[model samples]
Target: MNARTPRLEEVASLAGVSTATVSRFLNNPAMVAQQTAQRVQAAIVETGYLPNLNAGALASNRSRLIAALVPDIAQSIFNDTMEAMIEQLSADGNSVVMSLTGPDNRRLEAQIDAALSRRVDAIILTGIVSDLETRKRLKSQSATVIETWGLPEDPIDVAVGFSHAAVGREMARFLHGRGYRRPHLVVPRSGRSQARASSFAEHWMADGGEQPSILEVNIPSHFGQGRLAFRGLTDLEHRPDVVVCGSDWIAQGLLVEAQAAGVRVPDQLAVTGFGNLRLAGDMRPTITSVDIDGARIASEVHRILRARAAGEVLPSSLVDVGFRIIARESA
Candidate 1:
């Protein structure tokens, strides 16, 4: 006959404690005395007793699981924020599950449903939800939801992110102040990027400047798309003096293509990027970009989620992790 699995009651009996005390120790060791904790640990080791988390979850109605949704992690733009969130959540005795929903609303909706079915404690989304069905489904669910990256005017539950429009205005001001006449924007074909581009154009045009040249590519863009954008921009009748890219990858591509085409950066044409990636500084002519502190955003998100889980009254449900304009030689 197979040996029966040691139960929590058996561990408590061996450790000279009540079953409730053993369960408390398993859930939160700090709540138990040091001597009692040591004894329980020893009993667990001796009896090889493993806590049945599923059984505990069933009793408490808490899965202690978090699900995070991202558009695409291929470029690893949100890796720092994700890592920090996972680390902090793990410290709180929770596990994080990630899903790549890309840019499709259907895929995102499916993932959201999957997470809900698993009874996740919370759901972390990369950006604002535009799909009405997905938004409705999220709102109807009981799980805590947090939207990151860009602040949505109407958040599902809680929103923690920076303003993309603010980023655009700041970048425009920075470049215009640097004496750039013609400004052009190369961005991804997404609502967030388009919103930023609009803000930038409005800011530039409001100051008696010419209408900025704007171009966009499909989502999940790469360095190659940046090269294509640069080619298209240069071929235009009125070539831009400074170009702002949606992401650093695109700006890097622009730089590489410019070097190949004998275009002098910041001399013949100034260039800038967003996200403030590592390669932005390593390039021959470093790229100027916006620095959105992903780690700080993650910290704030974890704090809100943890507080809500603890039934703490929060001062506000919205948090804005601001951005900074990093100046470099590229612009």
Candidate 2:
């Protein structure tokens, strides 16, 4: 014979609370006193009680779940933001379901459908939603939609990110201020990188500099791609004085290759990179890169979610958590 499942009434009896109070606490702990909530939680653990999420969601219209969609999690660029977001959501008695959309975002729609079917309370995306039908569905749903990493002119609900084009323009000015005229770019063939590269080239030309050379590499960039990029640029008749890279891994690889080839960084060829990752500082010569504050972005996301839960309307739907250039030895 098998043991019977614990009942909600049994939990209420153990916690010395009414069945209605137990139900309310289970649905939203914040609605009950902290001391009472603690007692209920203890009783739940002691009784091995599992709340029926589907039934609770139907009653409260909230699943206490957030779905996070990212293009790639292997890269360190998104690590900090994700870690902070998960911590915050977990503290609020919410669970996070993450889906890797891959580099091409081909799995985005499917992931969204699955998340919606589960009645998630919120959906967080790493980039802007581009699909017309997906955007419309997200907007119509009760779930709060938040887009991160890039600021779109028209967000589905809310946006928290900096401008990629601004980052590119700032890098161009930084290189120009350092007196590097012949600059070359090595970037991954992604939308964000392409935006930065385009802005950098346009800014460089507008500032009376010659047209910079560009080399597009594959996504999920690694140090090997950077080394190959360096070799390719060196083989050109007009060697660039500086190389701007889309990622720190690529920049580090190029720096290593330059050292092996008897070329001095910042003296023979300066290098700059995006995503101010830890490796950028630990390298032989520190890399100059763009730094985006992932923690602040996460905090803003949590704040917005809390406000929405309280039935508060924000004054603005867009939040621009800006970026800065970390000036290091390489540049």
Superposed by TM-score, candidate 1 places the C-alpha of residue 141 at a distance from the truth, in angstroms, of: 2.0
Give TM-scores for every candidate, taking all chains together and pairing residue i with residue i.
0.91, 0.93
What is candidate 1's lDDT per residue for 36-133, written digit by digit as tens? 99999999999999888899789878888899998878885788899899988786668799998875434887888899989999999998898887
Per-model clash counts, in order, read 0, 0
lDDT of 2 by residue, 15-44 (tens): 999999998887657789999999999999
Whole-model Cα lDDT of every candidate shown, in order? 0.87, 0.91
Measured on C-alpha atoms, candidate 2 has an lDDT of 0.91
Best-fitting candidate, measured by lDDT? 2
* Error at 124, model 1, angstroms: 0.7
Q: Model 2, stretches more than 4 Å misplaced?
A: 16-25, 28-37
TM-score of 2: 0.93
Model 1: per-residue Cα lDDT at residue 183: 89
Q: 259 in model 1: Cα distance from truth in Å?
A: 1.5
